[model samples]
Target: MALNARLEIRQGQGLVVTPQLQQAIKLLQLSNVELEAFVEAELERNPLLQRDDPEPAETAEAPEAPAASSDELEFSDTSTAKADEAMDAEGDDRFADDPCAGGPPLTDWSRAGSGKATDLDDDAYDRALRRELTLSEHLTLQASQAGFTAAEAGIAQVLIDGLDEGGYLRLDFDETAERLGCSPELIETVLLKCQGFEPCGVFARSVGECLAIQLKDRNRLDPAMQALIDNLELLARRDLSALKRVCGVDDEDLRDMIAELKALTPRPGAAFGGEPAQTVIPDVHVRADPLGGWRVELNSDTLPRLLVDRRYHAQVQAGSRSDADKVFVADCLSQAAWLVKSLDQRAKTILKVASEIVRQQDAFLAFGVEFLRPLNLKTVADAIGMHESTVSRVTSNKYISTPRGVFELKFFFTAAIASADGGAAHSAEAVRHRIKQMVEGEGRDGDVLSDDRIVELLKEAGIDIARRTVAKYREALRIPSSVERKRMLKAG
Candidate 1:
């Protein structure tokens, strides 16, 4: 009884994330580009998979006849213009059929996974149109026509290469000199030469220098402006009266000068750089139907259609006599099939979820930001008869293009706060947005919108928030206190 072990059978429920489930989760989180790449890889690997309605193959014609003359080549009667005109006509038809001609289109995710026929205005249209000019391209253009000598131009190229994204020359004179194997004085000269290039404010050593350089180029570098830039710390510290007195400028003139100074970019390098915008390929499209409800559809352009090659897989299976080979082939086939299934499920689930969101948030679209009700994963999950976790998974990294704008599925879910009048739950994000608007519209000379005053205003607007809550929200929004806000107003 003490040593012998008893064998017993028991049943218990356990959740297992099969390969299919894992693939669905993974597909949910991938950005549009990554998803496209994944689909392409599947297409290459899967023999049964083919692009739906592949474009007709273009045939290259053999030379119709040998050249008639040594100096002249005979032109075909079918000219490039005719071909271009035909292409243009086809393009016109394509555009005529485009559903998203007027505004950003809302697309469905069905096209993303099913590899089925989809509307032309699919996910590919959401990409940003602007292409950033790289530093090399920027510098090369300027350097080529900079009017500098060969040696000077070379030095300028070196300096241009050393510039950071903000277009600022980040290296010290001596360090740059050492790298160039030249004296510090020579480095300084090259810097001067480089500064004369296009983008007037570039090659500046500091914020003050950058602004000063720009002002000089504009021929607006007066003594007062010069002094202010030289002593930016003093300007930031509300020493404007001192600045006015020292610069011998009156209040209005000083104000005008300060405004002008503010217009100049402190970080000139920023002119040539920006944080790349997060590109979205919407998983679903929701549009206002003529029948007076939202029409939900999928963005098909971004999706890669795929299917397993039954023949190749069968051949491998047929030839493989060994257990190891059979096991490998079987595993691969199972994985491929699972991947396709997961992708289809992912698209369908996304479409289902997005349709629900549009239904719930339709009021938000009809009105504006003010009508946006507080929504959460639990609410959506309950409505759709799914677990909160499933809703969360569906929303993760998924974007929905709506009439309001493109928003992540998760963006609809925000913590709610009670409205002052005990009406409906207000979104915290909306409250913050309201608070920002109030602060922005506050008068400079009159009563400053204090946290208490903001609370009172919000109450009148049916947002019934407390003074402490207002203060908390204000602080969270990085807004200064009543006293600080008053002082800033006075200074302004």
Candidate 2:
């Protein structure tokens, strides 16, 4: 039989991702710093959006709203508009009533004494507070002040350029001399002069040379000290007897020399010219409430308070003469409204997910990592009446600060490992922590615990992990094997 195509009516439902929905999804996964940058860009593009200032006085004095159920917390157009209106009014006041407002006028250093002295003082202070000079810049400054001849200065500059971050000269003097059209002896002389610069070890060709230079600067470069410095491998192995024979020193003198060597810097130039460390800012904070329960709240410092200026939108809409301009204004109003609603929804979702995580991991929080229970995304998602994907999005790149410390939200979730006695499963993280504790408590004088021994110990403790699994966890904790640890102990 031949089939004929015909139009038929059918009823179906599907989800569609609009541009605004995509933006809201993106906001859910962004870190605190990234969210701030995104909101700043949106504020620049949409003139109707503005940032709300943080006011502690008003927040403290205002009556708290009644607690709402989770169902009532879902995103709604009416509630979102009311919230935006309240935020807009709160931000419009340039000078709100303050108990500490009736004070004397503060001093304005910008207007002090014709401003010339103030400018000079400010410049000098700023320069002092700025970053210190880099390694290359320090060397160059010292070379300029050393009173070198023109040709000798050129040679010194070449040697400085050839130096590595450890302040070691990695190039051969003969090769440098050939490249610069000079003799090796002249190059060596210039190198010696450059080595006299600050930091005590700028142009050393090896580790021994670096330490020797520092010892010479301190007038402690005796024959015994030089011999001790030459055999660093024996020192690393902690062979005090070999060092005594090589340096011809007794136990007391060897101990003193070892202490002196330990005080020296290995990489002199490492203290300069690297990116500054970044500080982690948490999105949520957990603290104990006076009512005898944990209080989980979004960090106001990290949370962005944004509002749509409805008054501005109304004025622009009233002034529009053409249909296209009116449509443009209406589109802007719609976009601004959607953005505010999305932000509010995002905050509520994050708070809900984080609160549930804190509730499930309460044992871990109250005790320690050893007490952390097994948890997964579905467990949290089902408890909160949301999809697993939504829970994943909420945890990604977000951080929470608790009494313990700041940790990523994803740190609370761990894979489950079956128990030996058919009881509740154990958390992988807890098992790893237990393994680490056991290894740390092992006796140094006795035999080290092998992977097989560890597996047996874990089984005795009601954990059913394999020997290979024990080894994997040990490696993850950066602990060496039994043989390696035994070797290290013997050497020490």
Q: In terms of lDDT, which candidate is strongest? A: 2
Q: Report the lDDT tens digits of candidate 2 across residue range 269-386.
A: 6777632324668888888767665788777677676666777777888999988677666665555555565566677777888888999988756765445567899899778766
lDDT (tens digit, per residue) of candidate 1 on 335-371: 4555555455455556666777777777766764335
Each model's backbone clash number: 12, 0
Distance from true location, Cα of 179 in model 1, Å: 51
Give per-residue lDDT, candidate 1, residue 306: 50
